[model samples]
Target: MNPKASPGHALSIIPREQHTISRKNISKAALRVLYRLNEAGYDAYLVGGAVRDLLLGGHPKDFDVATNATPDEVKKLFRNCRLIGRRFRLAHVVYGNEIIEVATFRGTSDEEGDRHVVDGRIVRDNVWGSIEEDALRRDFRVNAMYYDISDFSVRDYVGGMQDLHNRVLHLIGDPATRYREDPVRMLRAARLAAKLNFRIDPKAAAPFAELGPLLSGVAPARLFDESLKLFLTGHGLKSFQMLEGCGLLKFMFPATARAIRRGDRALCMLIEQGLENTDARISEGKSVTPAFLFAVLLWGEVRDLAHTWMSHGKDGNDAWSRAAAHVVSEQCQRVAIPRRFTIAMEEIWALQPRFEQIQRKKVFRLLAHPRFRAAFDFLLLRGAESQAMEELGRWWAHAQQLPHETLAAALPAQHVGGDVDTGVPAPARKRRRRRKPAGKSGAS
Candidate 1:
């Protein structure tokens, strides 16, 4: 134990018929894992976020099983089990679309087993211990509770039940020490607080700003996964506000934080509005893309960088391209955005200038672009910065709805003002002087 964590209260167990979480509420695959583990003579319980979410009457996205059985033992019992990870060995029971994560009880990092502590952080930990030790090793009190399959009771060793009822998020031990052990926990603190609409305890939130930089040491790939959970899962706006409040946003996205701090009100509103749109779409079961969301978040900084480059005499297109690349590269160093989304984001930014080119052929070509819808949404968000942009969005909106002939007639040959002149039609092809037809060429 950290010496700061509560020694723990007497275990509270609620029997089968007493709780709202019926076996049917749990995923069948998870139920199978639990039953098998129990049948194999090992303790198995539905644990972590699933238990927390179930108690709060919310449907858990997935289920996890914690057991006294080691990964190898668990693997021996289930033919479908695949052992994964070294930091914490886990057995994943796969059933087509669903996976049940089974983890062995984790022992303390302060002990001398398979755990390794380097510079206050536990870089590797796979030490197995009892259920009580496992509960103590969890980051939050709410996530420490368990749903036992044997007696169909919830096991609460920490004050998770009380904290859940109080609508509070509390760290299990001394926050500073725990935070040092895994700075990503800070991000989790913000995310869970936002997702559950729970207030973080003062003690838990106090060390956030001071420990924000610790996240830099975490894996960029892990941070990318965390980013999705924060922004794409229907509670983006709240999650963003929480990340900003705790000073972790800059660590994750330095360019965005700089833009916000520079009093870019338009950028701020665009981000909030974009998040609002995403949340609404997710709630309505519409598909959302990572490319569009990332474009919205990084546009202001990219635009500013482009402007600086243009002032130094770089061509407008080159400047935009460079800016997009620069910002994306910087962000990638912190969160590994896969190439596909990054490429889409760049296309969305590059198309902004093309929006001003409403010539008949240009308009048709832009409309035919695969990324048109995403770029158009990004353009709409940019409407906050310029009247020309707002008018351009409106024109595109109307044009897309117009009859073909009517749209052709509506073009007046001059209505583009997006910091670029795109209204000039392609130069009329030069007529070749006819030779004397080798003697009688056509008279011009």
Candidate 2:
């Protein structure tokens, strides 16, 4: 492999025999799109993270193709192709469950095509240009490399291969300028660092703290999608630590950061344990839910608020309901968690207090609730709070193992008034006998 100048940039072409990427490892649908584009006489290459992961000896879940063919021109070739997006027009070629995304090479100049910029942000860009320009447009060096399907050669224009070998993430262009164009890149930097176990280049990481607040201006719905990618990808614990180390956590999740800063060690433990369990579940091929994730992330804020309300002489159930509502409403302004997930989160928090009621009826009712299993799992996470909590988790675990009738028989028959936590029931009401008043009145 050697460097050669192409138009305005130096491109390094690594021949097929030199790289480890094999055609058999790539998805069949992606291969079909690449071959079809090549057959049509258009320059097409497997681009972006798919190529990056392939070069790293990993199997990527999604593949994207970049070509000189415009979206409309590409659509003409494939019957399954459909164009989407106005911010950046793209073609989606669907092959059952997999989608091969095809994008036209993006141009640098705004003079030729429709491109809009507001407050240093690119709202819409549909410019067309050469492959060299597109390489310069990519956010990170590691994601800028392209794999040419026609010649089976890997092309590097931004020293991405060297950076990959060093396990360091380097941003393309000026860091401040790139971050201003899209603040979400700041979060992406942290996420990619966590996902790939790569260190960020000092120059690239220098601007994150100062530019962190830019995330507040991004769309909440978009942030919600990004959050899923960060926490549900089997690396949530590391991602969370990276966000805090970068000083970007507060901007993305104010309530969570606030609780941690207030010396809530138990809260921190709970969160870390929850993320660790989530990662384990994903690695084990078990199903995970976004509602459960959001529930864990927001638990600290709700727990603290409910305690405060209860201290102020509010009813226990009312305090819990109010706190859950307040925290969920506040969080939605930042991440826009959907109503369905928020409802489930609230139910999980509400079930916490019910665990203290060990009476027969209350125990059976909680066991029968629709959210019982999720709420029970969440209860185990609270073992970080105290030894008592750990014991309570054990009790529930034991209770679930026993036969339904046996467990019901073991619990107190009636819920008196004392603290069930101590196993001390309040005094039962004494029965009073009726007097024979009618006979006395007749005698008078």
RMSD for each of the candidates: 5.4, 3.7
Question: Which one is best on TM-score?
Answer: 2
Worst 10 residues of 2 by lDDT: 418-427
* Each candidate's clash count: 4, 0
Query: Could you tell me the C-alpha RMSD of candidate 1 in Å?
Result: 5.4
User: How well is each residue in 319-424 modelled by candidate 2, as lDDT tens digits?
Assistant: 9999999999998899999999999999999999998777789988999999999999999999889887877788788788889877766677776544323333
Residue-level lDDT of model 1, residues 171-240, one tens digit each, is: 9989999999999999999999999999999999999888899989999999999999999999999999
Native RMSD of candidate 2 (Å): 3.7
> TM-score for every candidate vs. truth?
0.91, 0.93
Scanning candidate 1 in windows of ten residues, the lowest lDDT window is: 417-426
**Which residue pairs collide in model 2, if any?**
none
Q: lDDT of candidate 2 vs native?
A: 0.90
Alpha-carbon runs more than 4 Å astray in model 1: 1-8, 412-444
